[model samples]
Target: MGSAREALLDAAYEAIVSGDWAGARMADLAARAGVSRQTLYNEFGNRDQLAAALALREAERFRALTGQAAREAEGDAGAATAAAVTAALTAALDNPLIKATLTDDTSGLLPYLTTRSAAIMDVFREDSVAIFVERWPDLALRPDVTAEVGWICETAFRLVISHLIVATEPVETTSRHIAEVVRRLMRDLTTT
Candidate 1:
């Protein structure tokens, strides 16, 4: 990404966080980014595209954080799972854009994180499965187990999204429970 594009995205995020996405004009965002409105349009095509790009960028950041947490957990798959979930939930709690979108329905940015999140979900699932296979190479040797691993990754990602939208427990408690369930599931699959 060029500096101009980065600036535009930063400005868009700030605008959405401070107010509503629907109320944010292209010209205003461009001015905030220190670029022309035409430049913003050239980079993003339109507001919807810009919004999608911003949402994807944020998702990627979360993905990177979770991946890093998993990698830093040494050789313990359960510990890696726990660390990844904790990192995601903790980051979501502090993300102003997430808070803004969840609280303000009129933001027009909710779909990118919720109902229309297929792209984000797909990337997360793929990355998660890769992480699992890398940590537990035996899973990749069995087709059935690999499929189960994908399902588990999808389930874990959905659980994280659910917690982000509606929290029932503390981050630590939720993450620990998820890790325990995942560990049991993996154990059963491996032992079978």
Candidate 2:
């Protein structure tokens, strides 16, 4: 079932990247995945559901990459934050789905990354807070500080998303600026 689901998602991804999502029939996708149409509907329920699932899967991929970047710079909070932002922005720049959505989203898929992005935002915020708490466990000792950490995480994540949508500067400059802002914010939060 898992393999079938993955294959279906892979097929969906290809269709979306090719600007054929609006015309991609479930039967076609099912055939592309070498599965029956019933199996596709059983796995994802409907076309909209399948689109949401694909968006969610991509969000998880971004979360994983960002988390790994943070972990790699475990000892330095600023460096970790910077690395995470860099990874996200870099990935977004290279991601075909993102490019497709940003350029010409005929599949009505922009909502998954914009107005309807609460779930995606939650994924990034939760993972980022976990990373912060891991690095500075002292944050766990204070409930208020922990909440602030979540806010900081959301802010940083939103900044990266903004850069992904409309780039006014290079990834390096934006990432460094966000990192500096996070460092200042953290200093204020931790000192008091």
Candidate 3:
């Protein structure tokens, strides 16, 4: 990427992580990255596009991390999947950029997710399914395993929302629920 592009992303990311999303206004971003607002727009299109891009970038980073963990987990799909869910939840809660995006009322990520824009959240679903399928394959899954996987991902994402956006519970407490989802799913697959 060009320096300007890198700078914009970096500045946007920093502003989010530092609780300065507002300070990251377009003019502020342009100034911080040594570009004009027009240049920033030219590079990233607009603020909404910038937000989406940054959010996707963070998602990519998360997927890469989970993918590595999933590979390390092969042959032990259940154990690996459980661990991956735990790791993903923990990392997402602790991730400044993620927290900023999900919890930041001003930015509108939560509404977008809660609404119909699966386009944004689908990355998580696709990445999760891909990682699980890569390690376990359809043959390994019980007849009901696919449904279980879907439920697990949906519930886990909701927990993240509840914990971060609504402040309904502590993160550590919420992440443990992931274990239950995994347990039931994996047990079904492994048993009959």
Off by over 4 Å in 2: 74-76
Evaluated against the true structure, the overall lDDT of model 1 is 0.86
Candidates in order have lDDT scores of 0.86, 0.88, 0.66
Candidate 3 lDDT, 1-192, residue by residue in tens: 488887898888877777777646798988888888998999888887777777667667876776576567645544565466556667876787767767677654555446633554566666666666666686235546666666665665555555555655554455556546665656656455
Q: Give the range where candidate 1 is weakest over 10 consecutive residues by summed lDDT.
A: 71-80
Worst 10 residues of 3 by lDDT: 108-117
The model with the greatest lDDT is 2
| Poorly placed runs, candidate 1 (over 4 Å) | 74-76
RMSD of each: 1.9, 1.5, 3.8
Per-model TM-score versus the true fold: 0.90, 0.93, 0.71
lDDT of 1 by residue, 68-132 (tens): 89988874556778999999999988999999888887667789877888888887888888898
Q: Looking at model 2, how many pairs of residues clash?
A: 0
- Give the best candidate by TM-score: 2
User: Which 10 consecutive positions of candidate 2 have the poorest summed lDDT?
Assistant: 71-80
Per TM-score, what order, best first?
A: 2, 1, 3
Candidate 3's displacement at residue 36, Å, is: 3.1
